[model samples]
Target: MFEQAEAIAREMKISRSAVVAIALEEFIRRRIGIVPLGEKSNGKIVVASTDN
Candidate 1:
């Protein structure tokens, strides 16, 4: 995955760390259901509900 990250970093004109950070943030917000960018965190661990 490092190779992909490197390519994306070059394409985006950003550091590899920045690309990873952005990807992690999106993963947390979507897959993990963490709070969105603007809201406050409750200092509690959040787990997405499995029940559908």
Candidate 2:
């Protein structure tokens, strides 16, 4: 998923680590019943709420 991740990171001019961190956070947020906002793929952004 590095290729996909790098693509997004490069396109957004953000570090790959930052991108991954965002993804993980989104996943956790979703697990906690949060609705994130963004596209999700092998290495994409996901939408999950942030209401606890």
Candidate 3:
């Protein structure tokens, strides 16, 4: 798994640690149902349901 991650990091032109950090952050955020800010907008404040 580490070797594969290294390959991915090289291909993405980023450090392995950076790749791992991003992956871990994304995993934790997904597990906790966190949404990225500004992911959805129409130039207005709107209440949107994320339960898809």
Candidate 4:
């Protein structure tokens, strides 16, 4: 997992911390049943809501 993350970070031109932050945010949102308003693409995050 760490290796994969490192590769992804390099590919995205972002730091490891930034990659971790995004993963954490996604985990938290899923745990709390917060669904994104629209499909994600190009590393963009859409609206978040609890109204799944």
Model 3 CA deviation exceeding 4 Å by range: 35-52
Tens-place lDDT per residue, model 2, 1-52, is: 9999999999999999999998997799679765567756457676454544
Runs in model 4 lying further than 4 Å from the true structure: 37-52
Candidate 3 local Cα displacement, residue 19, angstroms: 0.7
lDDT (Cα, tens digit) per residue for candidate 1, span 1-52: 9999999999999999999998887687778776655555696544443432
- Please identify model 1 stretches exceeding 4 Å from their true place: 32-52
- Models sorted by TM-score, best on top: 2, 4, 3, 1
User: lDDT (CA) for every model shown?
Assistant: 0.77, 0.80, 0.73, 0.78
Which candidate number maximizes lDDT? 2
- How do the predictions measure up, each by TM-score? 0.59, 0.67, 0.61, 0.67
lDDT of 4 by residue, 1-52 (tens): 9999999999999999999998887788779776544657456766654542
Better of 2 and 3 by lDDT: 2
Better of 1 and 2 by lDDT: 2
- Estimate the overall C-alpha local distance difference test score of candidate 2: 0.80
* Model 1 TM-score, 2 decimals: 0.59
Q: Clashing residue pairs, candidate 4?
A: none
